[model samples]
Target chain A: MYAIDIKDIKKIYKGGVEALKGISLQVKKGDFYALLGPNGAGKSTLIGIISSLVNKTSGKISVFGYDLESQLEQAKAKIGLVPQEFNFNQFEPPLQILVNQAGYYGIKRQEALIRAEKYLKQLDLWGKRDQPSRELSGGMKRRLMIARALMHEPCLLILDEPTAGVDIEVRRTMWAFLTELNKQGVTIILTTHYLEEAEMLCRNIGIIDKGCLVENTSMKSLLARLETETFIFDVDPPTHLPSSEFFSIKQVDEVTLEIELDKNQSLNKVFAELSAQGVRVNSMRNKANRLEELFIGLVEKGSKNV
Target chain B: MFNHNYFIALKSIWRKEINRFLRIWVQTLVPPVITMSLYFVIFGNLIGARIGEMNGFDYMSFIVPGLIMMSVITNSYSNVASSFFSAKFQRNVEELLVAPVPNYVIILGYIGGGVTRGLMVGFMVTCVSLFFVDLQIFNIFVLILSVICTSILFSIGGLLNAIFAKTFDDISIIPTFVLTPLTYLGGVFYSINLLPDFWQAVSHFNPVFYMINAFRYGFLGIADVSLIWSFSVIIAFIVALYTLVAVLLSKGIGIRS
Candidate 1:
């Protein structure tokens, strides 16, 4: 059975805000899935519904074959959610928060203490575990929430924008920790505005837009759909531009050029062409983040369809 | 396994609430003790000295049980109201709602917290009163039962108020307008038999009157209301409030929306 299975979920909030419009999704067991969407695109609402924080207007949902309505305890036991906001008590210390959350899941006091210390040290929060959570820095609080969510060692962990405001270095560290956790066979569903983060960590991607599922596929397959990618080339001053008929090249002054090349087209042919014209390439990279480009394309297409 | 998880959930919530009040002892425990002491000094000593005997007992001892009940009701009501509403306002309630704990367990956990605070404050107030009056218990079981029943009733009332409250203002409105007025008119200060016939009839309608008089009956063997009637009203309110709270939680009313 899938880790998460949502069937025709519809959410019509109070006073007629249709946040989710008959959406269906499935995540296989042990898969690292990314649920991507722009703000107001219903990603958080969908997550809320899955976790039973928000009541749905209509739909069926299940986690690890446990129906949410009929088997709520089993379903809840299988999933852990780190919400977008800091919902923990600010007065409580990180250690207490984790221990309390573990207790909520039936872990005894001694086992909860052990799990709390384990996650606190693993998340680099053991040193400051005694201080009030409000005194912690923003990144520390975010990591604390993750540790608290993981206290029960749920089979499926859902994180909503876990690193939205984190600094680059801290975000990198979080990425490494999350990668290690995923490697240990935890199924994770992550929603993040950072497309590169999704591209790096998530194996499958589901893109939602305007209360509709726009795209859902493997990252490899999704990237494969991109017919053309723009690559920036840094060339020596002696290099001459290739024929405009064969390649779409946009000049970036004396020593640089940008070209939109088809995926089927070979970089070797372009190198041979450049060499024949006395142009030596120094460095080359994509003009835009590949996943970002696809994301924008998908969202724009979805908006147009709307 | 599920039942054990539910039990742990209740324990965790109960511990957290108790910790909260204890951590802020100055706000939760000390203020009530001070306030009740002032009542003892002003009402029991000076005023009672002028009035002398009331209902065949010294005025000081006569009002002691009523004053204790007053503190319990106030503390219990305020504890649950503020705590639950803050959870709603801060949205931390989602933590428990998303857990596998049943709604009844959630209500029971919070009620336990409120009852603890009420009982703690009541006990402290009772200790303070002993300095002003030589107290005697007419019946130990009746006294314990009255105080607990009254505390639980008010705590449940507070929870219901909190569930309906949308803002901080909404939480305080009922206490200030409805609760305080009803409490003061509940005969904590005077026996209803001393009042005029019409007002005495009206006093019988105030639910706090039953709680206070039943509690007073435990102390001085004198009551303005029947113990059976008082116990019945308090238990009925507790049952009705519990049912409502459970229903509200099940429907995902104000908190969920």
Candidate 2:
């Protein structure tokens, strides 16, 4: 069974705001799936519905084969959610928050304490466990939420923008931790604004646009769809620019060259042409992250189609 | 869901709530005890001196049950209201909502906390009243029943108020405008017999009057209202309010989208 199977779910908010149109998707068991969307594109709404925080207007959802409507408790038992915003009590200490969360899942106090300690130490929050959660830094709070979610040892973990404001070093640590968790047979569904993070972590991708599932495919297959790529090359100072009809090259500065190559073009040919013009290349990299370009392209295409 | 795990969940929520109030004992426990003490000093001692006996008992002794009941009612009501609303305001209520806990378990857990605070404050106020007047328990069963029932009733009332409340001010509105007026007129300090006939009829409409009189019967064995009628009203309100709270939670009225 899939980790999450959502069938044509819809959520029309109180004031007639249709936050999600019909959206159907599934995440395979043990897969690291990325649910990408622009702001207000119903990503949080979807996560809320799956976690039973929001009520859906229509359709159905199941977690690990347990029906959300009929076997709600069973379904909830298998899933844990880390919401985008900090949704824990600010006055309580981190240890209490995590242990209490485990208690809500029917875990006894002693067992909850052990799990809380394990997660706190793993998340680098053991020393600050007794302090009020409000005293923790922004990244620490995010990590605390993740620890709280994992206290129950859920099979399916859903994180909604868990690393939105975290710094690069902390983000890397979190990524490593999550990768380790994923390797331990936990299915992870992550929604993030950082395209490179998604590219680096997710095996499958689903992009949502305006309450609709715009694209869903394997990461490799989706990346393969990019028709053209732009690369920035650091080259030795050239007296003249390279002439090529197969690709377009422009001098960003005296030594920096920007080249746009279509799918039909080869990087070797570009290098050969640059050598022929005596413009020896020092280093070359994509001008923008590949996944980011494709994401923008897909979202823009979706908007135009609408 | 009504298994060992359910019990654990209930206990956890109850423990969290108890810890929350105890952690701020100065704010939650101390203020009510102080307020009740002042009421005893001014209303029981000073005021009772000016007015001799009321309903065949000394005025100081007569108001003891009402004052203790008053503490129970207010504390029980405010504990659940403030605690539950704070959870909602902080959005941490999502913690419970997302868990496998049944909605009724959530309600029971919060009510358990409210009842604990209510009974604790009531016991303390009773201790303070002993300094002013020598108290007597006319009926142990009735006394325990009235106090526990009244606490449960008001705790459920507080949960209902919290479920509908949108802000901190909204939580206080009912206590200030409705609860205070009803308690003062609930025959807390005087018998309904002392009021005019029309006012006596109106006092019967105030639910607090039944609770105070039932508790007074428990203490002095003299109630303006019948014990059976008072217990009946309290139980009926408990059932009604409990049902309403359950419905609101299942529907996710204020806590969810």
In candidate 1, how many Å is residue B198 off?
2.1
Residue-wise C-alpha lDDT for candidate 1, range B161-201, written one tens digit per residue:
99999889987898889888888889888888999999999
| Clash-forming residue pairs, model 2 | none
| Count of backbone collisions in candidate 2 | 0
Q: In angstroms, give how far residue A114 of model 1 lies from its true place.
A: 0.9
Clashing pairs in 1: none
Instruction: Name the regions of candidate 2 deviating beyond 4 angstroms.
Output: A234-243, A251-256, A275-283
Instruction: Report the C-alpha lDDT of model 2 over B131-177, residue by residue, as the tens digit.
Output: 88899999989999999999999999999999999989999999999
- Stretches off by above 4 angstroms in model 1 are A233-243, A251-257, A268-283
Model 2 C-alpha lDDT per residue in residues A1-306, reported as the tens digit of each score: 999999999999989999899999999999999999999999999999999999899999999999999999999999989999999999999999999999999999999999999999999999999999999999999999999999999999999999989999999999999999999999999999999999999999999999999999999999999899999999999998777888888889999999999988899999999998888889999999999999999999999998
TM-score of chain A of 2: 0.96
Q: Quick one: best lDDT, which candidate? A: 2
What docking tier does model 2 reach? high
Question: lDDT tens string, model 1, A1-306?
Answer: 999999999999989999999999999998999999999999999999999999999999999999999999889988889999999988888998888888888888899999999999998999999999999999998999899889889999999999989999999999999999889989999999999999999999999998999899999999989889889999888645566557787888898889888889888878887788788899999998899999999999988878
Per candidate, native contacts kept equal 0.82, 0.93
